[model samples]
Target: MPLKQPIGQKRLTNVAIVKYKKKGNWFETACYKNKVVDWRNGTETDLDEVLQTTAVFKNVSKGVLAKEKDLVDAFGTNDERAICTEILTRGDLQVSEKERKLEYENLFKGVATVLSEKCVDPNTNRPYTITMIERALKDVHFNVDPKKSAKVQAFGEALPLLQERFSIQRANMRLRLKLAAACKDEIQSRLAEHKVIVESKEADGATVAIVCQADPGLYQVLLALVRDLGKGHGHLEVVSLAVQREGMSGEGQASGDIQGILKEQQRASELSQVPYVTSQPASTTGRLRARSEEDSMAEVSYPRGPISGIPDDVTRKPMFLEIDGLQPGWEVELTKRGESGVVDAVFFSPSGEKVGAFVQARRAALSASKKAAAAQSTVE
Candidate 1:
């Protein structure tokens, strides 16, 4: 049997017949190389020799092989086809095992270099050397496809290994909060749920001041919850502390002085107050002076209009109005001639509870208009 073709080798056979005239008969032989028949001169020459005289011929060797039919289809002239075949038949296209190994090594080195620059050791806060990265890579087993580019192999396969081996540290944080009396219970419950270290809690009148420390990752979530609970009324301050180096702890150190912080908090609270005069009332109208000396001399008139059939009482202070729809039984103190007078009218139920203001006014006006129309109809 004929010898089997080697693996990855293309099958090539001298199947074309070439005939030449001898002394008395014609002789035939299988053609291994391409040939051309010059009918005009009856001459035969190798295709390579024929192409050397043409401008299409170059001194470069072929890197990949092409079949005879394919070469003919690719080029318009025989000389061009022969030149392409020669260059393709050369062995420059195939990469050796050693070269492929070297390329992969270069790719791995590039990946290590990138990680060294971009990533740092979490314990020391310093970048890892290339040798350290290479050592880490040795512990992990992975395959790199030679077909992919170096950048793809580095990021897709190598980067994840480096990141998994070396992780970043969570940051430490300090938080100070000035909690409002109304939301103190809710805020404390949330803080306890998060398990933050509450260093101190001091009561300054109705408000509670608290200082705590926690990990940044968990603190961020807790901070959002606190802000939601505060609803623009609470005050919070966050400070970032320097990262602790390896083998160091802040446990034994004395706590820093917080007296200055408390003093500042007191000053801020003082500034936020609205000052009012403490002088006696002018005529029992229950209107206190605005503390403006120039305006104090001018007589401030109070409105005498009744509210929802409840006549204004100049002697007695207006009762705090308990409204149903306003925050579900929340009470708002109303005065006869102050902010409450801005509305058209106020409404109260038979049980002496405030209902609504503007809505009741609209209903009363419509009812009175309807009564007038009915009376006119009866007279007609």
Candidate 2:
């Protein structure tokens, strides 16, 4: 219902006049009842312009008035304002904004799992503020206006707000591709297991169904990955890798793309002799064995990816590693630089089992050719 009653001659002294300077223009936005209304862009001036501009909507409960009052009461004094301004100038606000963004990202990590687990209404599917929808949608052509960007930001600030249509669109795309791939793989594996020749052709450029003897177990695995996405990092393990064929006979047709890629993958997997995956443990056994062989004789160990040492208060970028039974004066090499240097000292921790190897820059090793050249130059 429209608020028809007029606030006649009622002087609102405590009314907040929020004047934000953005892109060189001052925007006077009046907030009440947690709603933002009556916005105008003009010169930054006293409180009169904001009050006059918003007087028409004064009858409507501006929800933000309560929040504004709370904020003012919390830190309204000149001293508190000075502290806030100083902190903002020193980039504390930027850091705080970054922390908030990080929190959003961390929360969004479980979204795929949540979506996969249950059948949700397409209409109910909305992009929560936890997901960076604007960043995801920046490349989308329609919502490129500056006003739209601000609106998106505002929506993001009030988190758990749903962008239903947008979420459904992306979710449907992800789900379709994922389910299709799983279906195809399951069908092919079952066919091969039953000694049936699984041949996929893209001759007509139509959607191809993977044919196999029906197995109820494969379907369960698919449901587990899709529905239990949040549990056991299920979403991460469920791979939906795109299989693309480049410079194929088709010019503009997407007809052969899916069929060709699937056939190729099927052929490759058959050749490699992929065992029937009854469980995660059986599937990982081979890979784990290979990794164990690789790391067996080595005293130092690093994870498969980058080994950036833990972040410290001083923000030092040096790499640090603690290995068990690391002997003193042994060379330690970080793989990136491919340099092995003699350890400066091997400090034993209080536990006595772990040893920390510290190496200086100068004792680094070089390739045989480099060493040979240096020796020849010294002789000369």
Candidate 3:
């Protein structure tokens, strides 16, 4: 039997054919170095013919081989078809063909420097020397295929467009990651806050809803009111509260007194300085004295221990304290000493006695600072 061809040689045999499987997968059979693979499945008889063809010429057909030899005679081995194929596979595949010829002159001009320094000549298989490489680079044009042809072009061109697309994708991914991380951190930190667990009947199941006791809408409205009061009122604050069972009993007294005090103070402060009365009422209607001076004949309904002397407005609405920026946790010390100092802080609590430690500390600090500043300014 004839010597079996090597695996590589068999892969490129003249009869190299591909047959699609029933599932439509391509199957490789035989091949040759020069002849193209038969995309249409050639039979055993066709394979025999291909083998005969291969026997006549080892690599390429006789005509091609003769042409290669003739070109080499005039322009040297640089013009060899084998060399051209090698150049195509290598970096020279990017070379522009418009400025130069297709044979030795073009190939050498395109890749001589690169072959000298970065690559080796296929035929010689020798490494490129630095001096020869430098000489080639100086004379050679960059062998890059420009994306826009005298033929057709698209909205986005080649590599640069691809790079821009990749960059935008990367940025969006990073932004999403950052947002996710921030949300996770917030959920972990605020988890300790006491929330009312509300149950909702849904189509699938009962959903547990966590509700914050502090009303965000009320807080926002209060903040806006304070802002309108100017920078001098930056320390002013308000809190939302709900009345307890016992607290509702004193609503009438609290509402009357609180509204009265606020209106009197506001009127006095405005008149003593620069009073510009507008059509808008200072406080809600039917709350404060209907007629400002009409209440002069009214008897003072003062409570004995002063605790019963709560304002009517205070009684109607829930009791809330106004304080400076308090973080969390503070004590409420209601004493003669507290009265002497500016009531700069307000304490929040479910019970009357125990106050938030954070609010107390904050109020104490702010009051001390304001007093000290006033004292210093007086002395100066």
Query: Which candidate should be chosen as best, given TM-score against the real structure?
Result: 1
Model 1 / residue 107 / CA error / Å:
1.5
Candidate 3: segments with Cα more than 4 A from true spot: 1-263, 271-331, 335-380
1-380 in candidate 2: lDDT tens per residue? 99899666645443433443322322232322111222222232333332333322212224222233333444453243332232222211112355446545433433322322211112212122212333323223222222232333333421123232122222221112122333444534544564432233222232323322112224445445444432332221212111111111111222333233233323323322454221111222343343234234334332222223322421112323322122222223221111111112223332333223232212221233357678889999
Q: Per-residue alpha-carbon lDDT of model 3 for 158-247, expressed as tens digits? A: 212322211100000000001122233332233234221112111222211222222222345334433443333322222213211111
Q: Which candidate has the top score in lDDT? A: 1
lDDT of 1: 0.42
Q: lDDT, candidate 2, residue 203?
A: 21
Q: What tens-digit string does per-residue lDDT give for candidate 1 at 1-380? A: 99998667433243223333223322222223223222112244444432322222111122132333443444434454444344333212333467557657765776666555444333222234455555556655645665455446555677666455333223346788887777777877888888776778888778887888665667567667667877766777775342221111111112212222223223322322422221211111111122122122433233322332234552221322222322122222222222212112234443446544433433444555577688889999
Candidate number that wins on lDDT, 2 or 3: 2
Error of 2 at 24 (Å): 42
| Model 1 worst lDDT run, 10 consecutive residues | 244-253
Q: How many angstroms is residue 176 displaced in model 3 relative to the true structure, after the best TM-score fit?
A: 21
In angstroms, how far off is 56's CA in candidate 2?
Answer: 27
